[model samples]
Target chain A: MNLRKLFAGAAVAAVALPVIAVSAPAGELTIPSLVYRTGPYAPNGIPFANGYADYWNLLNERDGGIEGSKINLIECETAYNTQQGVECYESTKGEGAGALVYQPLSTGITYQLIPKASADKIPVFSMGYGRTSAANGKVFEWIFNFPATYWDGATAIVQYIGDREGGMDKLKGKKLALVYHNSAYGKEPIRTLEVMAEKYGYELMLLPVDHPGQEQKATWLQVRRERPDWVMMWGWGVMNQVAIKEAASIRYPMDRFIGVWWSASENDVLPAGAGADGYLAAAVHAPGADFPVHADILKHLYDKNKGAGERDRVGEVLYNRGLAAAMWTSEAIRTAMKMHNTKDPTAAQVRDGFENLKVSEARLKELGLEGFTYGIEISCANHSGPGRAAIQQWDAKAKKWSIVSKFYDRMPEITGPLIEADSSAYAKENNITARSCN
Target chain B: MGGEFLFFIETTISGLMAGVMYALVALGFVLIFKASGIFNFAQGVLALFAGLTLVGLMEKFGLPPWAAIIATVGVMIVLAWLIERLVLQYLVNQDPIILFMSTIGLAYVLEGLGDIMWGSDVKVLEIGIPQGAVDWLLDDYGLYIEKLEIVAAVTGAIMVTGLAVFFNKTRIGRALRAVADDHQAALSVGISLRTIWVIVWSVSGIVALVAGVMWGSKSGVQFSLSLIALKALPVLILGGFTSIPGAIVGGLIIGVGEKWAEIYIGSLVGGAIENWFAYVLALGFLLFRPQGLFGERIIERV
Candidate 1:
């Protein structure tokens, strides 16, 4: 009787093991998106979050997920606060297939998650923001800020100004002002700009605006008195709108005023009305919702009444940026699958894939974003891809932004050394051994 | 020397214009505190709600600008009545801190409701307020002044005069002042405390609407509209919480002082001193005058 009972218990256990395995499928990929859907920055955050979610949803509906492995996309709200962002990261990192990658969408949060992500063997994609020196993959293997860094942006803006001034030599004696937010994200470009100033013999004036910068009467008053040749801004949220309005109030030439990518959006331009007509900003992707991928999104998501945000805002600049980030994430997952010959890859495997990823022009066309953005390539030694950017001008009359310049080459001569120096310093401070990538 | 003097003058004029808007928000706090003896901390959220309602009514219902303004004003009055009935009435005779804390909770509720009603997009409040710099001023004095700011200054002056008249000349206003002075004595003389509280809240709501229009017209109507309350706190601290005239004088002092500090002293310290200059000035002033610039002095009897 005891022998019979033992055999029966073993048979029942075997049956239950298969059921549990089926319920928690091994071939599922989980991506955790730390979003700020409600906060002072919600106007900017909501569209980006919607776009990110929509792109993934389109993939699930159209292609049945990446390489036949269903994607489990989980969103956690951080309200644009760093502490909440870390909490969101910790809580959601253990869900489902266990967060293959994290996109914090905030520099402050990305800074906090850098060490934590390395320890957890999960890759972090700060995209266009965060610590600019994280471009040096030797010290920051788990972090990726591709397309461009703040230093790259600062150099590109200087190049654009040089082009307008006839040549790089003409930049000498030119006075340029930088109106930036008073935070780590805002101060990222100061050192780069200063280096450029010393090299080109131009004067760089720095103006720091307090957070949520609604009041800029004094700052612009200084602008009027000094009358810098060009005013470049690194503002976010309400700060961008107020600066533009104040710039207009001072009768400053709008064409000469350029803002960083964060300040270049319809929400920023609309507040200042027609006075923002000639305002220019740095952009990593083309603006508007005219891409073929947008049509797929509309048909699969909005048309079926499953859209995440306003249907009209589907192709806005920031929306397209979010879509671009989601595409990069999906491509990296595909690379992991191809590289490891596995239906589902671990977080560490995904990091390996991100290191070896390349999104060519042909791939973008196939993905229906042919002209939506420039091609991006990442590797073991370099994390910030190609570091190219374009200048976009807001057409106040049309209520949209248009790319105004061809892609400017990334100034690796200026940024490369800075990244090496900063990253090396960080490595020594933290007792981290720099990795050798062959 | 000429350029420096001209720049200083330009900064002062611009600072005064900005100060008027701060005073408008501070006046809302003074009105409620004087009549009800409750420091209504939700004044800034009230402005945000008022702006959101105006914009929402215009956009969602397709109402014309004037019609939207009227409808929004009606909504604010109804909101005041609801607050008096649902919140204030229940918590009567509570500690002032309790009342202040209740308003803070109300601010959160109103802020959440505003976002839900209007959607969380930054909206342009275009009631046809003039934008762009005044060309003549720019040509004559090389001074750039936003025309919209000039309109805001004039509007603020008119609103302050109207409020001053309403507070001093009307029978209900006189009774409201009586309640502010001594609630028990006013009640004994047949003045209704509930009626006075409701009236004061409604008046403050109107002041909030004016501020909303001015500020919403300046910047966009968004979450930052609620943050303007933080800006008004320094103004209140400088002017005294219960004085309307004090609110305006305090606002000018802070606005001008900070602008000057940012221009002259800011560069020495790497420029962005406007944020803390106002608070520092208020703190320094408070050390000298414990009752504020115009607050009623308290004499304790042991």
Candidate 2:
């Protein structure tokens, strides 16, 4: 309590002040993906998320850690809740993040974040399923729905059905019902389908399922009565499984059933077992653990006890999808870096990578997505790059996916005028000149 | 019309499942009301907290699901005793409205505590409850049901049956009834008022656990279970505070009745009639039977 004690106390107080004032470290590049891995929609959400994170982690561990700078993924699980998704977005936005390119797997979350992204200048690359109008990129400069929108998926669905029915000329008198989850995501494809229905002469039925995707008995009961020739599903999570099971219960032909990329996954089919086998679903990416990249992952990280999940799920459907999502997001980062030639490139640099990016078919096959992914390209005016997808089918006996349809390109009859009008609308709205393909 | 009819019936089944869930929550309210004559509005949040505890214990702490379930119920018992001692003990003779308000505050406290503990991720409850649909009568429409609902229904029934038998037959149950009837008399008759209050609340805690598990298992455990408890308030009105059998009957009627209304009448009003049906039914019941279906009738004496 005397002279020596006073000096010790003063020393302790002096040491505490600097420690309190010290700011957090800024070296790590944090990316927050608001993906729902658990919830009613988890079956559909988990795989893409796992794959996305897997690809990111793999690049970190395998590829000299993302341009030799370590990346820290601050995970905030939203369980597909809109408010939780926003909260996750807000909380992680301020942590010295190099670039904030959120992949909010839910369309509703995407809609909520669009304005925020513009204010923050953060990029929102919603690989698939966002506002089709946002594809213009002028009004939504910070938003990038690369690959294809649901509208494109819708055209592809109708187109695939047409090809199955002989050709586009044989589409008349064909009845295709659009059974969609009753949300922004589920409803995205309907307007496009409506437009295509007028040209194709196929009657379209729109069925809306309530949230959580559990109860669809009544929705399918109508399918039994009217008996549509083909059904396009826009569902997520439990809704995906319930839709398939109900379709089975109604004795609807499994081959005629088509789900969007989100609606098809191992979780969706495994719960209902082999009854949903042969159910066709649209794919924006390849599936399986047998891909060369996945094999490398297993041999390296997994074999060395550093894999993210069960080794058995290495090339599983959702796991691969999640890995693909992460791959594209990281590749975009790589693209941005290669363009700028700097490790500390900002969000603007990342956007430039998105705007002037290319991932061709040859490069994809070389990357061991071999026959899986269709090549993609991006430009300023058109953010939804390459715009190609092949249909994938679940072979229940094999317990794996097999590519069914060849790369079905977008018909200009469907995308042409819509693109023109959208371009004009975007040009007028943003008060900017539209970019031309010189 | 035929399709819409099936849709209505299907909605009715969902509504009933929802209603059965509501009744399980309402059971906690009925327990407190019958034992202490105080409406515990915190029942919903308490159920949520209990469910969160169970999930945390199982998923995070690595306990087996069955062990977690047992441990969670044990925690609820201790929580009930602590609440009776620390919170409700001082408010014994307070105005009923003030006591009710205390419960409302407790509800907020419980919800905040749950958020702090569990971090608000909606967890898919896997208590091994069945999720498939059941069909009777040519499997077309009428009574098709999800197996989860049936488990909830049976669980609620067992809870109600257990409570009824306990109160009507057991020594402690008689002591509880005596306390509810006349606290002064019960005190004079050598029943410990504190002990009796503790037992009733602990019993109510068990009820909360049961309801919490079934509801959480059905709708993915989250803080949203608190909102489900709000549905139980009107349920108390229809069942009468002093009645156990009344609580069960009232909950069933509300559940099945709302389903019917939403299905038949909802189609005419663009299909959200289920939201307001309970209140409308309450209004009609209030006009015809103001004391509730089995609630005690009051007479003007002044």
Candidate 3:
């Protein structure tokens, strides 16, 4: 019923947002996307890439593309396979490109593409799931995983759990179970959990659920018997719903289940409905259909028959994440173009564009993204431009997810040394010389 | 002694619920292996698809609970018929291994098809199966059980009993038995092979629907339903591919045994026991009785 209303509303007062076309008088600023829109993992990729394409299209229509230069985006479907990802990269990276920046979305692709991207003067933006050590801009100049790395999130989750247990001391001897997808994404957080276990004296149990996570009888039974005080989920798509239901079936306290941002959504919760009340997920963006951007999307793009989805669901968790990614990348391109002679620039020029990038608090306020993020500032030393995250809990009463804790401070002291060691190890393993900060 | 003992007892009962779910997927494996000599690697995927269908109908189409369930069952029956006519019919008399490979391919096809039909996102299935708990006993300590888990156990038992009766008494069941014994012999006796194959696949599809509902309700349906099917291989080995009762007993044992091992021995061995529990059990059982508990023993007379 609500879906119908949203669709109806969209069909009403929506004028299409003008797109910014790339002048492309000579060479084009090519942004290649290796997306998996039709696969097992499609649930996560479709919305993200759809939002990405929409953003690029909006730029083309609104501002004649970035820097008054039209942006040409070539999407090569890889179906989330690394080999296919490389194939896409190889095929798409050579077409009159300027400031080559790739967001592979898959960590494996990120790892495989990093060397080539760096060699080709392209920058890889791995928002959350790539090499944590790349947080050090000195070692990995071309790779950028902005905002929050998995390690950063792991620490943030640990801190939230500790606070809920009364204090850091309360975490002593507590059981923290990791119900994770058996993939690179899930494995990213375990090292941090192990570190936390040693420092906090909490018992950490690792449960690896195979991809898509719907059948977890053995794992959940362990949860029932072992009774892990808390379960931290690092699953995506259908896996999230499965873990939550399994937890509910065993009558495990829902409050104790903490899903990583990717694992929590309307998609995850709607299926479980009332059964999934009281669960928690770490969110980096505000979740609601009420944001102005959502409203604008409905009134402008969707209503005009130009949006990717029904107009009403504009500010959904995933839609917002998609919007955020598009907005951030576009803003970076805008900034890059602004710096490059205020005209068409090369991919190398975009590198100079992202090098000293700044999205101040004032700009965030102007953009209505103030509370969604603290501030995004990218520099040579810091690839995770913004270092902040917040916790949101599912409230059955409201039938909505609500934010509970403000952004908790991450311990840079602990993370810094780990970053150094990681960079060193990465350099050694990959057989690349460590680029010194000097 | 009392409090800790009560805790221990409560955990075990909870552990049994876990056993029931394992048995659910295992029953799916047994169904296919008994009638059709194929392992049906697509069992887990079938469950995932069925579960996705139920949740999709309710959330997307606004189908009422009873209607969605009836429709899902009807859909599964159709799916069974389709498999028999389309894939199985073509692959008749092929190597069993080749048949297994086809199902593996079928697994991929089902997975891709499910994603396209249902957009890529995990859905919450609140069919409202029971949530509270049924009170039971542990003397000083009360043992509580999830109403959902109870439903799963009872449903499984009922399904198994109905299957046993159907096989022993029904005409089609006799035809299935004759086909299982010797395909050519059954064909010569005038039993329609096409009809028998359709019946077998349809029955297997129905079993998938049951497993789908139980596992989907318990875990929330997703593509991961296929992973649960893989775990059933060991269960099938222990229960024997030809025995229904073996699937049941084997499921309970795998589910409960894995839980107990993970808890009691996890601490001793860095705490991961569920990973290899079923295989170890199957190995030990194979050494003593290779044909499995309920499987007929083959004796060669030279």
Instruction: Count clashing pairs, candidate 2.
Output: 10
How are the candidates ranked when ordered by lDDT, highest leading? 1, 3, 2
Model 2 agreement with the true structure over B1-302: per-residue lDDT tens digits: 87667665655666666667777878788778877878888988888888889988888898988999889889888888888887888997888898899888888787777766765545556767765556452275443456767788888778878888999899999999898887789989899888987888888877888888876654456555666665776676787767777777777778777667644554465443444567777777888888788876767698
- Residue A366, model 1: lDDT of 97
Candidate 1 local Cα displacement, residue A92, angstroms: 1.0
True contacts kept of each: 0.75, 0.00, 0.48
Per-model C-alpha RMSD: 5.3, 6.1, 7.9
Sort by TM-score, best first: 1, 3, 2
- Candidate whose DockQ is highest: 1
The DockQ scores of all candidates, in the order shown, are 0.64, 0.14, 0.33
Taking the tens digit of each residue's C-alpha lDDT, what string does model 1 give over A149-230? Answer: 9999999999999998999999999999999999999999999999999999999999999988888889999889999999
Worst 10 residues of 1 chain A by lDDT: A16-25
Measured by TM-score, how close is model 1 to the native structure?
0.96
| Model 2: per-residue Cα lDDT over A105-205, one tens digit each | 77888888877876798888877767676677655677888788887888888889999999987989989988877777888877778789898788987
Name the lDDT value of residue A371 in candidate 1: 87
iRMSD (1 decimal) for each model: 1.0, 6.2, 3.8
